[model samples]
Target: MVTIAKANAELWVFPLSGPTGGSGITAVDVIVVDIEDSDGRAGTGFSYVLGGGGATVAAAARDMLERFVAGQETVPPQALWRRLAGSLNRLGRGYGYLAIAAIDVATWDLHAKRLDMPLYSALGGVARTLPVYGSGGFGPTQDPDAAVARSLEYAGMGCTAVKLRVAGAPADLDRIRAVADALPDGVDIMADANEKCDLARAQWLVNALADVNALWLEEPLPAHDTNGFATLAANSPVPIATGEHHQGVVELVPLMQARAVSVVQPDLAMMGGITESLRVAHVAEHYNLVVSPHFLPALFIHVAGAAPSIRWMEDFPLLEPLFDNPVGMDADGNISPPDTPGHGIQWAHGARQEYRIAE
Candidate 1:
């Protein structure tokens, strides 16, 4: 049996073009993991922090690798994930999950490469194209006219849907209306509050979004407010979408069970990599809920191939520039997983060298 020979983790930091809406995130910290087996095969995986904490995550990854992964006999990625997570049961789930995420991703990539198949096919999925929504161009403070122009730009690109950030204010309704009025007949609109509202304002915003014929209202309240979500979902006309902030399937199942959320948005790092995120998608399917992952369409398009519940992929291009050949949107505004072995993500020629943080 092949055994893990060595595992290494590195930290890289890249500044965003500007501070993002609501979160005010000005930079992204990437923790990259590379693992090689006794037989000489290698794979790559990564996790990210929105604003800070790269060194902590990288350190955690190193600890986990040295303690659990190195020299261990090869196992299925799912089983390996369970082992690592179970060992950390008492360690609290903050940055540890992000650390596990990078290793889990790398393990999955290695498994796919060993089998001489693309990740989707290795995960028991056929290669298929999935729909994408334009998820940029409008921040919480953006003007309605600019929002309309951005929506039109997405429309020109053949995207059927676009998402804009909302701040749960009275003017949010007018802003949504302006964009809706500008878009063509079939194109849909979605709004993300980014956890900027309390229950009262979230309730108001949901009704307002429904009145404007929006596709959905995302993260209106904080992710932990399950009781509020259940209460609001019971009365809201439009669907509520959340899940990016949640850490694992354990946290998501409660929301799904209560019928609190209609759409589940899993982030790769937040869900601790493809293994748990896939579990979330399958669990969402059982609840008859829709799955639209948070970002990194290049990585998630593979998951979409494996999970029928994933109907939409977000096209917020944050980390795409760091990769040499990320999958691109089709002329029809849909994206598909690459047939190449593994996830097919490679750092650009000098990206690692340029962004690597000195230890």
Candidate 2:
């Protein structure tokens, strides 16, 4: 008989000194939700620890949370979402989704804590595992030697596949060649343009990399350009993947219908949380599309594991250090959902004071 009382956001900016090939991400804020029930047990939810441009998202979440769930019963995720539909006017879809996401995760955490079960087990406990490709820690157009070394390191770390970032068409080809050449025979090499290319250049990159046996090409064009995306999806020699940045399930309905993307990569934080992601997975399933849950590896992994429709899971072996009990990958290349109760992360051993407050 407890009710929700409060919420907050946290940013974890663990500095990476080595720089590596992973681009400009110096830190990430794992958005944390503070919830006080009538019984006095406080539960926290972790959203995507988005670095770089995600600070705005953290700033925008609190107002929405206060208006929606500060004094309500820790209800079903759907009930929380129902409040969202009505309150979304002040907070637009993207930020609104992030706000809802923090609370949804908190609700799931609260539910699991109440039931004394792990999040995965509550979601239909399956002894399921999936193949994971190496992701993160690579960037757009790095030194040729550095790129090759980086790709090889991931392959050596038991990853079945590795992804690299590509930029302009000329640099794109070189990046593909460097990483592709570095991988072992059976390991697949994938590339993401990170919304860097136009349709024609994207087509060129895909066609040019035909010799590399790349598993997929991700976000060559900006995420919103569905027609351009479809054009690339249809023409690219590589399998086209998109959807990490989209905000709602409605946005995905058209993309699925048009076959604009090869992999549907809805992130848990941005795609309206696990509830909405499940809906998107069904839509992708209906269209014969491959659903790849992007980023926030822990949350997305559960969504992927729970849904029968999903095919591949993105792996970020580099991101393990931030969590006190960060989830790990198994021999089959899949991450085992945390066995502990809830979404499964405790603050790391030396977690920064109150979740990495930035200026």
Candidate 3:
């Protein structure tokens, strides 16, 4: 009879060290959710928007808590997720899904804590290490020499793979080639166009990527461009990757079924938390596609433990500064989930006070 006793949501904004690679994202707006049971146990969860929109997301989170979460029994996390999602049938899935994501994560955390088990274990997974790829070294307009230097730094740190941002320009090919040439043998290179290219440009980039023996080309076209992705993938030399902007399983199915994507990268918040994210991973496994979640390896490490398709985790470091003790890449360029109960993420002391925005 452990019922939910209280729930709260807050908005926090953190400025990036600099504009992010490709997207030029300058800040992140995090909506934090906390849920407590009648027995006084508590759990925490969060979702974020890349540039801005903290207030809207936070408000939606609050409304969800009031309408659907309060006074509910501590049922299974998936059950709560379905209820939350069903409530949004008419409201549409845009910001509502983000709001549901925060609540769903909090529910899972509380459920795992109640069982006195780590999140991965609660999800029927054993702790294991997954390969990590270095990301965020090369921006779209960065100098080739600087990009090569950063790639070398990541390689020196034991990264087996590195990702660079690419524009649809001719010079982009040379930039990727330069980085590839500088890296040691056995290390791999990946490129992200951030949905900046058209069909023809994407086709050109994929062929060039193959010439360099690159691993894959991510988001060469907009996420919804299924026709373009299908067309490009059919003729492209390199594997095509996408899914960060495709929302949930509904949006991802077409891309996967069309064989348009060789790798599926699910964003935790965008997928409405771990439950749905795992669903995406399992579906990818069905299609023999690789599952490389977008950013937050510290969090996705848990998902990787359960989902066999997730072989690589991106080390983007977007939200690491907010956590007191985030997981780090090992000497072998891999990261493992913490054995502690729940997700094992703790906010830095005074982080909430420093970043919280008033309503």
Candidate 4:
């Protein structure tokens, strides 16, 4: 019997835009990997493309695929992750999450494939599909009416909750009130100031939202404003959420240690990948916190399903048409994880005409 063989990688981009913090996702660039053996079967993995900027750390992935991990015999998933992870550490930059993210996820893709089982089942089977909330609304809404209308639309779609943006605009309080007034009872409201609010103003916004029963106040202060985060978290009437900007585990652990956030909201694609998110989850769990991934909800859902403390997945449904068969959403607003081999991502080849190479 032949042992194992080689691996190959891809730099990809899908044409669509997702908006956040005044920016829209004009593309989805990722580094994908395919690993094969002496007998010829293979498994695939991927990472954000140059931080989803059109290059999936391609040069680095090429280095790893060529220098290591390509022709090795199949090993335990954790061991392979460590080996790929270790390479980045030895380089001393630790800016290799693209390398780390691509390999680690692909390794799991391979493991799930080898067993012909969905990733969640391979890990431990699903605990629950978990509740999901509508993530983005009032994003740079030029018209306050349009913004409030959009927020209500999300709630009307049966989302258990909704997140509205406050651009640090002068009438931010009015916008919050407009949105809260639109949402019905039992449908919770959360607000993101995108760090537009300083500690003092964040406190003011939190207090203003309290009358509306806000579920949480997200990133009211700039991300690095730890004292601001602590000040608000310690005293804000609304729960505080953050972590979409943290670079890696080292940074996140300390934040969790300080009780800096009520909810650990890591973006899977941005937080390096499932590997680092799991690390964040452990820290969040140790501190008795909830892990709610920030975006790219389709992939994040699987990771969320695996964490015992995952409170809810982010399922901003507006982006559904961007994918081939968008994730399943229901009348009650529950989001379900697909029982597929990989993350259930399949690009429609020769179907969509807008496809472009992000790199």
lDDT for model 1 comes to 0.91
lDDT of 3 at 105: 80
Error of 2 at 70 (Å): 2.6
lDDT of 4 by residue, 1-359 (tens): 43357776666655444444444555556666667667555565666642264353766776776776766677756676567667766664243666666766777777777777776766654836666688655574446687677767777778878777776566776777777777788788887777677777777788888888888888888887777787778887888888877766677776677777888888654566677777787678888987778766666667766678777777654334445685665777777778877666554455234543433
Clashes of each: 0, 4, 0, 7
TM-score for each predicted model, relative to the true structure: 0.98, 0.89, 0.98, 0.87
* Candidate 3: 10-residue stretch with minimal lDDT: 135-144
Clashes of 1: 0
Residue range 1-359, candidate 3, lDDT tens digits: 88899999999999888788789989999999999999998989999998787799899999989988888888899998898889889988888888878888888888889899999998888897988899966798788899999898888888999999998788897788899899999789999999999999999899899988889999999889999999999999899999999788999999999999999999888889888999999999999999999998888888888899999999888889999888889888889999889998889999999999988
Ranking of candidates on lDDT, top first: 1, 3, 2, 4
| Each model's lDDT | 0.91, 0.72, 0.90, 0.68
In angstroms, what RMSD does candidate 4 have relative to the true structure? 3.0
What TM-score would you give candidate 4 relative to the actual structure?
0.87
Query: TM-score for model 3?
Result: 0.98
